[model samples]
Target: MKQPNIILIMTDQLRGDCLGYAGHPDVKTPYLDTLASKGVCFDRAYSACPSCIAARAALHTGMEQSHHGRLGYEDNVPWNYANTMAGELSKAGYYTQCVGKMHVHPLRNYLGFHNVDLHDGYLHAARYGSVPYRESQFVADDYFYWLKQELGVTADVTDTGIDCNSYLARPWMHEEKYHPTNWVTDRSLDFLRRRDPNRPFFLMASYLRPHPPFDAPQYYFDLYKDKPLREPFVGSWETEEYLRKDGRIFDSKTGPIDKELARQAMIGYYACITHLDHQIGRLIMALIEQEVYDDSVILFTSDHGEELCDHHMFRKSRPYEGSCHIPFLIAAGKNVLPDLKSSSTCHAVVELRDVMPTLLSIAGAQIPDSVDGSCLLPLTADPSASVRPWLHGEHSYGEFSNHWIVTETDKYIWHSATGQEQYFDLKEDPHELCDRIDDPDRQNRIHELRGHLIDCLKDRTEGMSDGSRLIPGRPYPVTLPHATAR
Candidate 1:
């Protein structure tokens, strides 16, 4: 059997339920929907840590947060892994290359790829006071330098007048071709055209859009400006934290500053996704034109999901479905993996950690014992196959510090800082609106899930649990190994 070329497409902060195939009533993602129709889609995929840095740690290392040591969003921590998915594929004679957003520390660190054309967009930490900024490697900020090259020295993220983390909406200041999403696709197509054909290639086309600054091209933004959008998910028991007047523009933790502006942000967000979808279409066409489409395995997913005003939350790092859930699709071309079912949806609870093993499996490469993720190929072949009974996920975000135990049917969450517990019947309320923690009939289920959470954290350093019960309000650092101490 011949090894297949692999293409991994990742978008940052994209919600899992926003796609047309996922029954989203508003957002349009034709390209992704088409790919999902021909492949296996994991309906319960999630980001273990629900933030860029920590989520990527799981994707890159194939290990859970507890083992990877990135308990939360910490930037500039060195990526010192001895074995990575790309390294394993490269060792097995695959030409590995990455085109965008590695998000590893030291910015230039390629992990184990043969080459990298990096474009990590608008990282405030790396741009301001972080070590990568202070070391005078500002030239290493590839997207910034490239933008300046095209628009001169005055080109800046602020030129769009939108905060990186805020829900403010705007169109790209320049032409559509100059957008980072388009640039990522352009470089990826260039790679497809120039890749070494002798060896099967592993290419990662990572995009840093549909994230924030809500800056899609004007035409793309126009696609949804006047269109109706579904209102954000708001729970009956949810608090009104978004109503607080924080007055901070760039880093406002809450959103829906006004319902009208929030709708505009939704327009921008959906437009960015559609624009990215079009770019993905172009990349696929390039592959077909290069005559490699029939021998390729293409996987598409996001690092984590965006809240988009869900339960008054704007950004990620929460335990809610809107923050943690993400899209996971694996599509093999006609000549590759012909035995797998088409248009199948797997209900197993998978996570970013599963990606490394899946890709390695496709490449016929060895997975190290250090990896905690299981290969998803078995589940793809037999949809009834179960990977694990449940998945444990959490993140540290001030008041939102939370840990969750999720299965195919229900979820139990523990907010460590507030000692608040919430339970939802995922089978009944996939939107997670009705909290059932207080339901008398479900006490036993809640206790069982809480026990699962306790077992998940008993071995960790934060002392999240005693032998038999959970401990709340026990504070832990946002970054393990402590970012401030670093």
Candidate 2:
């Protein structure tokens, strides 16, 4: 059998439930909905360390947080993984290319792609005055450099005065063709036109939207701006500590206090998603036009989800579903795997780590010994199959740092800084509106999940847990000692 082409479509800060197929009432993702209809959607996919850098580390290296050594969000750290997904596939004779958002240190570190057309959208660290000219986005990022060339040196992503992390949003200031989202697709289509046709190709078309600077083209904003959207999920468990920062604070991680502002934010966010969905449609069309659509295996997912005012929170790096749960689906070309299931949903717990092993399995390539993730292809054939009983996830956010355990039906969260605990029966309360942490009826289940978290942390250098119980208030570092050594 010929090796099938692999296409990975990645979006930043996209929620698992924000697509039309996911039954989201407000968001309209016809293209993604069609893809999900022709694929198996992993209903319970999550990011163990729900932040861009950490979740991406897991995806690239096929290892969980502890193994990959990135536990939370931190910039400027070197990515030194020895066996990356692209690198391993390259070794297996695939011509790999990534068109957007590597998000790794030194800006141009390709990890393992044969070539990279980099654009890690508006990274503040790379734009710092202390950063060398060679490493700064002006020279290091392909999209930024091209934007300047097309519009002159003074043009910048910040020209609209919207901070990258701000909840405020508006339409793009430049031509729609020059938008970073379009630039990624434009280059990706160019790659298909110029790729080595004899070898099976691995193309990662990553987009940086539905994240921030929520500047989708005006048409997308018009799609949902006046529509009645669902209000943010504000849980009963929310406390003053979590809601203290009002939404007016530009980049407030908490409340928008103003309901109208929240609605506008949603408009911008959903608009970006629909715009991204159309771009994905373009890529699929290109594949068919290139006559390789039936010989490609495509996977779609995100590094992490935006909080989007869920529980009064607005960014990622949390243990909550709004931040951790992410969309995951795999659609294999009919010619490549005719028996693969379509229009199915899997309840089994999965994560970014599983992407590597799954794709490698599809490509008939060797999955490295260091990979801790399982191939999910088998689950597509049987949606009820079990990959694992439960998943453990964590993130190191200052006072809100947390560890969590999630199964298909429920979730348990523990705040490391304050020793606060919250539990939710996800089956009954999918939005996580009510906290069952103190409910006597659910104590046994919560205790079991807590034990899972303790076991996960017992061997850590920070001593976050003993074999028996969790020990809170331990110093948390973004990259563990093992990663630093690398």
Best by TM-score: 2
In the range 282-385, model 1's lDDT, one tens digit per residue, is 99888888999999999999999998888877889989888899999999989988777779999999999999999998888889888999999988888777
Which ranges of candidate 1 are over 4 A from the true structure? 130-137, 245-251, 482-486
lDDT string, candidate 2, 383-450, tens digits: 88979999999998888799999999999999999999999999999999999999999999998999
Query: Model 1: clashing residue pairs?
Result: none
The deviation in Å at residue 34 for candidate 1 is 0.9
Indicate the TM-score of model 2. Answer: 0.98
Q: Cα-based RMSD of the predictions, in order?
A: 2.0, 1.1
- How well does candidate 1 match the true structure in TM-score terms? 0.96
